[model samples]
Target: MSKIWGRILWPLAGFGSFVLVWYLVAVSGVMPPGQLPRPDEVVGTLATQFRDDDLLLDVRLSVLRVLIGVAVGCSLALPVGFLLAWYTPLRQMFDPLFSFFRALPPIALIPLVIIYLGIGEQARLFILIYAAFFASVVVIYEGIASTDEIYVRAARSMGASEMELFRRVIVPLAVPQVLVAVRVAVGVCWATLVAAELIAAQRGLGASIQDAANFFQIEMVYGGVVLIGLSALVMDRLLAVVMKRAVRWQDRVGG
Candidate 1:
């Protein structure tokens, strides 16, 4: 009971402290008026948007884009990452290219994507795919590469074939690390999402934010920002749950 209450109380306490500090800062006259809105103002804006302005719809659209981007990117990236890790020649050939691409931010490719794909869902997806792919590939590759050599040696000594070694050994070791990559890529996707929507969005939290900023609606901006953070947190938590389930056998592995 104490542990449960601790889990519940600690997060609430931290949140309450953050809000209290924010409120103090807002009332302190440090920032310009109407810029850093107080907690109440943000809540009011949230209520108004949900009641009359379709903020929930915008949030849903933004979330959908992120989901699609991460899903598609992961689908393609994991296998490629594993291949790169498993094949020395291929890893040597592609490592430099992967590094170069990873250095390029998704937003920096916006103009090229727009020119090639046009400013539509394709462009948004392109940016998201870029963000998730590059962020995840290296992590996944490294995870596979870093797997315990003892496992490989033992499997080989037992007469395990290459495919058997991979299936019985490397995959179980890499899944957790790959999921870590997914968590990081989810953050990358969310970070790039607004830029994707900025291409020409009719609906999305990013579009709502742009509209709010255009009209100097500070509270609404804060509301949109808060929603993005919350959404990212939720997605990350879901990934954590998946990771926990997928790696449940770790404790049983001796050595």
Candidate 2:
């Protein structure tokens, strides 16, 4: 459809340009094929990878891990962020701890997590969850906290109860920001999932890329890297559509 292509044209053009530049550079002998695979060779490798029975399985498993972690992180973040923002005492008690944990990288905890949780799917899921939770909780909390006090005051002046003010005034305003946080959380989860898979997983894309490196399959490695970027782009576009739908007024204003 024209509308769909309109939305994607710029990104597609950019990607095409990137490939053109990469190919030109490689073909120019600036980087040998042994160092940087040609774009067409990478595409060929990707086509071959797609034909493999395990590629889809690996993608599915990685997506499953990301989804599980997103679910866990969001489930905890929403209620906790809301509670912390709503109650001063609770906010004081937890905010510093949240800040502390947020400062620590998920990769920093990978070794300890692997030691305690084992090199299983649980450890991978946990790492993703941890990263997503840290990144999301602060965003959501700030989103809630940043709700206009004027709106709350106006609602209260209209005899709205605290719950009503929060439900009707604060939450609706915060939802857009919260969704952005979720989008960011998704990206963090993907990165952490890849890091987790780099160590223990046998069939994940990251592991496949690592294997390709070991075997000197530069094309496969390039293809795997391209797949990861493409997957992220697809997800980001999907989320952008959802965000536009949810915040149509914002889009109208921006446009």
Candidate 3:
């Protein structure tokens, strides 16, 4: 169908344009040799790396770390966000603290994390969790807080108790927000991965990138960066699919 072709062609066209621009810039001699690799060079490095087992291992470890971080962080955030949304006093009491911590970059806490948890998996997870938690909690709290009061009043007028109202009305309305929070948390965790892996990580895309950079392997560095981006894009698309299905009942403007 024309619509299907349009959908497919548009993305391909965009990528094609980007690659063309990149090729032009690479050949422009703007940067020093080996500093900026052409797209083909990066692709070649990726293809070669794909033939090796280490790349797969790195990918698995990085994905696993992100998955675990998002799971734990979002789980903890849900209750905390709900409490903040539901209780005015609690929101007032903890809002400042949340804001303060949220303003602190996860990388800035690396030394403290290393000192407290040691340069181990725990420290890495802590950094990822910290990033994911703050990224999600704010969205979750705002989503719940911004729910339509008309729906709440209607439910109450129908003799719905607080618990029932929350379970049937508030929670359903907040489902979209919860899914969005997960997506945001996933993105934040990926962005913080390099920082997390700085804690003496043995294997991960971030660790591999660091290793490549140490050896002045420019192509490998580009490949690692590309892989990280592709991995994040895949995860985000999967989350988007889940979100679409989960919130299918909600009215929207278009597909």
Number of the predicted model whose TM-score against the real structure is largest: 3
Steric clash pairs (candidate 2): none
| Predicted candidate 1 versus true structure: per-residue lDDT over 1-255, tens digit per residue | 887666678878988999999999999999988779999999998999999987889999999999988888887899999999999899999999999999998888988988999988888888998899999999999889878899999999999999999998998888787888889889999998889898998889989989889999989989999999999988998887788788878873221
Segments of candidate 1 deviating more than 4 angstroms: 251-255
Where model 3 places Cα greater than 4 Å from the true spot, the runs are 5-7, 253-255
Each model's C-alpha lDDT?
Answer: 0.89, 0.81, 0.90
Q: Which numbered prediction scores highest in lDDT against the true structure?
A: 3
Better of 2 and 3 by lDDT: 3
Model 1: per-residue Cα lDDT at residue 248: 79
Residue 137 Cα positional deviation in candidate 3, in Å, after optimal superposition: 0.7
TM-score of decoy 1: 0.95
- Model 2: per-residue Cα lDDT over 89-167, one tens digit each: 9999989999999999888888899889998878888888888888899888887887778998899999999889888
Candidate 1 lDDT score at position 98: 95
Model 1 gets an lDDT of 0.89
User: What does candidate 3's lDDT look like per residue over 139-195, in tens digits?
Assistant: 999899988899999999999999999999989988898989999999999999998
TM-scores of the candidates are 0.95, 0.91, 0.96
Candidate 3 residue-wise lDDT at 140: 92
Colliding residue pairs in candidate 3: none
